[model samples]
Target chain A: MNWRGNALKFCDVAGLPALEPFVRLLAGEDVKEQLKGIAKFVVLPVAAVAVFLLLWSAAARTVVTDSMQLPSPTDTWTAGKELFAMHSAQRAEDLKVKQEKTMQAVTLLAQANSVTKQAESATGERKETLLANALVLKKKAVQAANYRPSSAPTFVDQIITSLKTVFVGFAIATLIAVPIGVLCGMSPWCNAALTPFIQIFKPVSPLAWLPLAFLIIVWAYSGTKPGENFFDKAFLISAITVSLCSLWPTLVNTTLGVASVDKDYMNVARVLKLSWSQQLFKIILPASLPLMFAGLRISLGVGWMVLIAADMLAQNPGLGKFVWDEFQNGSSQTYARIAFSVIIIGLIGLLLDRIMIFMRNLVSFGDPQAA
Target chain B: MSVAVLDRPRSKAIARPAPPDPLISMRAVCKGYGSGVTRNEVLSNINLNLRKGEFLAIVGFSGSGKTTLTKLLAGLEIPDSGEIVMDNEIIKGPSQERGIVFQNYSLLPWLTVRGNIALSVDRVFKHWSRGERRDHVEKFIEMVGLSHAVHRRPHELSGGMRQRVSLARTLAMKPNVLLLDEPLSALDALTRSVLQEEILKIWEEERQTCLLITNDVDEAILLADRIVPLNPGPNASLGPAFSVELERPRDKTALNHNETFKGLRNAVTNYLVAVRQKSRDDEALASEAPPIELPELQPRSLRVPRGRAG
Candidate 1:
């Protein structure tokens, strides 16, 4: 019984309420109600998706373009499979090439050792020639040992890049927004001063910020050569654009959350004679966490969306660039690959949202209704 | 008989001789909100003294600014005019010297019962070692009989349990003066009486100078050494103070049979009712004004006739 309750709690915490019906049913709750829940939460969504796929397949045959037809469900699945196969094959090939280079280096090192041994026992002119040969062999071995396969990133690698970029951008946005938001919340003067800038910049699109971000990053890194920089220029530019566009939600939410801490709680803090820092850390911040997380979720979602678009525009090596490059290629499989990518992007976005919700629930206190 | 004694003329001042030096004193305190014509005076020209180790209760109606008075004493709010002095120093801001149990059980919902109590103990006794502070918190939590619910958050606890945690939190601070603002008013009657008894037991043990703000006449008669009524507001002020002379280790059931308790309850209740009625009558008299006349008008039809339709 204890475990059953914990299971349900786990479901709630994980933002997976759909699993509750099954858990309840297993726990011997009302069967009829559980059945209804299963129908609503489990079966219906699956059925709806199936119906959608059927409709998509039917529609794909009807629409025809000069270049290619719209991708059917099967076509998209096939394209997704091909992409995954290609990624695995590329990884294997890279691994094989690295192994071959290592073997070549080993062989060259052995030859250099043999040549050095021969040079030690040789007479004057022959000894010099042998020593020279050994030196060349050693140099070649080092070059071979240091060999790397510089192949382009596959679809999976692009996805990983996109994920990394978005997370970095989200982290940057949160770092900048939360403290400023707290200042704005705590001090009316700070709020008033920042209001105009927030209003002006909030509505500016990521596309609009991209060029400005690019220019600033470029100017900042002007001294450093292209490959010598710590971060790639395009990656930094895209991430900055994402942060610029996405920071507003978190900023606004944190300000609201901090400002709207319950008056009663503040009175308690006062009665306790808590210092300003203590009050902020112990009372204000904890109390505002639910709303702050809600804001973070929105900011992350915005950041993810912005990152994709920024990637496409900036030609950053990510999912957005993959889609863009596919479009440019205009092969028979291009439409299908794009459709497959669309699904991946949507799923990733959904996962991000779910994670944020889970985090929000973790900090949410007092009222379940509030969470 | 105590009934005959109760029928005697009542006075506004405490019948008992005043203590030489009070722990806390409010002098001609006035607080209000708004400005000009819209200004609402909640407490005006209020003066009271909390003698050291005395249990004092201020009984009033809901809107009679009992909370404002509590906040003033707690130093959460400074009076608009006049001064509140504690230990011969003018009250500037809230300090750990005076701890308040709010009417709404202002236990931080995010904190567990232990955390709520420890928060105050940790802050107030900053010089104490971690173990000492923890023991102090545990002692108060046990005193309030909430040891079982130590790990429970405020929302997870019942209304009475939450109030108990609030009481434990304030008590854990070991303030020289304790202010309780209708802390049990939100609970059910059964829970209210239970908590009242627990509060009484704790008070008997600790004997801190305590101030209780409540609307319950019987509750005031039961727990407090003296009862002071706050008159109904716009400008609520203190009424007469009634001394509860009933012997302690007071039992609720025995108090029902006790004539002194009965008479004291009746006297306080009658006084509060009379003052409330008088205030209502004054408000009615002040609100009496000449009625204004309005112009009569008819609703005009906006429809066109059939002949005009062409």
Candidate 2:
């Protein structure tokens, strides 16, 4: 019975409450309720997805344009497979080319080394030429060692790129917002000072901020060559825009969480005579974490949504660019690939939210349902 | 039954001569909230002394600012006027010497029973080795009979269990002054009585100077050596103190027929009822007064301070 409770708790933390019914069924408790639980948690969701797919397929068949038709489920599936195949083939080709160049460079360097050893006895022009050739061979070998994939990013690569960009933006936003939020929550004076600025900036869209972000990035990178800079200008611009737009939810939520911490807890801290930092970390942070995570989940979702637009506007190399490029191409398969990307984006967003919920459950003391 | 008793007034009932040195002393302390026209006085001209190894319980009705007084004692909030001295030093803020078990059982929810107790033990006993600290924490957990729930979080525990964990945590700290703020009022009657016994046993063993704020008069008699009641007022102050002369290892069942128990219980009940009615009458008179009337002028040379609650 205890192990069954432990199993149910594990399921709850893992954001799979549906799994509890199976655990209860195995434990031989309340067969009727367990069966109902299984049906409600498992069977219903599958049925809903099936109905959604069927409707999507019917809707896809009805829509048509001069250049392309809307993609059905089968078309989207094929397009997804093709995208994976394209990525693998490109990776293979790049590897083969790099391997061939490396071998040729190694052979040339060996030849150059042997010639330089012979040139020890030789004088003037032959020795100089041998040394220069060796230098050139070593340079060639270094160049061959540097393997850069020249292929335009495949769907998988674009997905990874978008994830990376959004995370970078989310990380920057969290770092900036949490401290500010804590300051505001802890002090009425700070809250008063920051409230006006936050209110003014919060409603500004990523699209509205993109041009300003781009300008700032361009100015910062002006002294350096394009590839020599610390980060690509396009990527930085897109990320900054994402940071600007997605920061508000987390900031607002954290402030609310911190401000609303129980007075009894604060008194306990005082009675303990905990240091300022201890009170913040041990009492304030743990107490506020549930609401903070709620804010973070919202921020991540907003960041993900904003990243696509940022990528498209700045022509950053991510899924949004991929979609924009496909739209421009207007091929027979373009609509299907776009449909596949849309589903993939939605799935990724769902997964990110589930991961946040799992984390919230771990740190939270309140009911998991509240989160 | 007690308008005549109210006429006996405050300075005569329960005041005691001060011992030479006290663990805690509050002198003419006054506390209120807000400013100017909106200022609401909660406690006024309060004087109290807590001797070493004493168990004191403070009983008051809801909204009588019992919490405000406790907060002042804990040094969580400073009084508007007057000084609260502990060990001859005026307390400016909270210190480790004073630990509080709040009424709500303010256990950090994310922490398990062991973790909650360990948090305080580790902080206070920083000089102790890791094994010693863990051993100390386990000892308190056992004392509280929470050994089975050592790894359970607060949310998993019942109300009685949570309060027990809270008690364990405070006792584990080994604070010189253990301030309990209505810690048992939230529990069911059975659990409350069970805990009241547990508290008695623990206090007998440890003998830490404890101050408890509670609404239950029976609880006050059961656990405390001295019981203090707060009068109902906008400026509510300590009314009277009753010392329990009952023997140690007293039983709840046997106390029912005890003559001293009956006498003390009647006196406390009568005092509480009289003050509550008087405050209600004061409210009625104030409402009946004309709102537009000019404030009366007092003779500045002949003003006198109010008497302290005994």
Top TM-score: which candidate number?
1
lDDT of 1 by residue, B58-139 (tens): 9999999999999899888889998999998999899989889988988787889999888988888899999999889888
Write down the DockQ of candidate 2: 0.56
Candidate by candidate, in order, the iRMS in Å equals: 1.1, 1.3
Error of 2 at A65 (Å): 3.2
Clashes per candidate (backbone, < 3 Å) = 0, 0
Give the Å error, residue A159, model 2: 0.9
Which CAPRI level is candidate 2? medium
Model 2 / residue B113 / CA error / Å:
2.6
Which has the greatest lDDT? Answer: 1
Tens-digit lDDT track for model 2 on B188-280? Answer: 999999999999899998888999999988889988888878887588878767778789888998998999888888888898989899889
**lDDT (C-alpha) at residue A120 in model 1:** 92
True contacts kept of each: 0.89, 0.87
Give the C-alpha miss distance for residue B105 in model 2, angstroms. 1.2
- Per-prediction DockQ: 0.69, 0.56
lDDT of 1 at B72: 91
Runs off by more than 4 Å, candidate 1: A112-139, A368-371, B1-20, B290-310
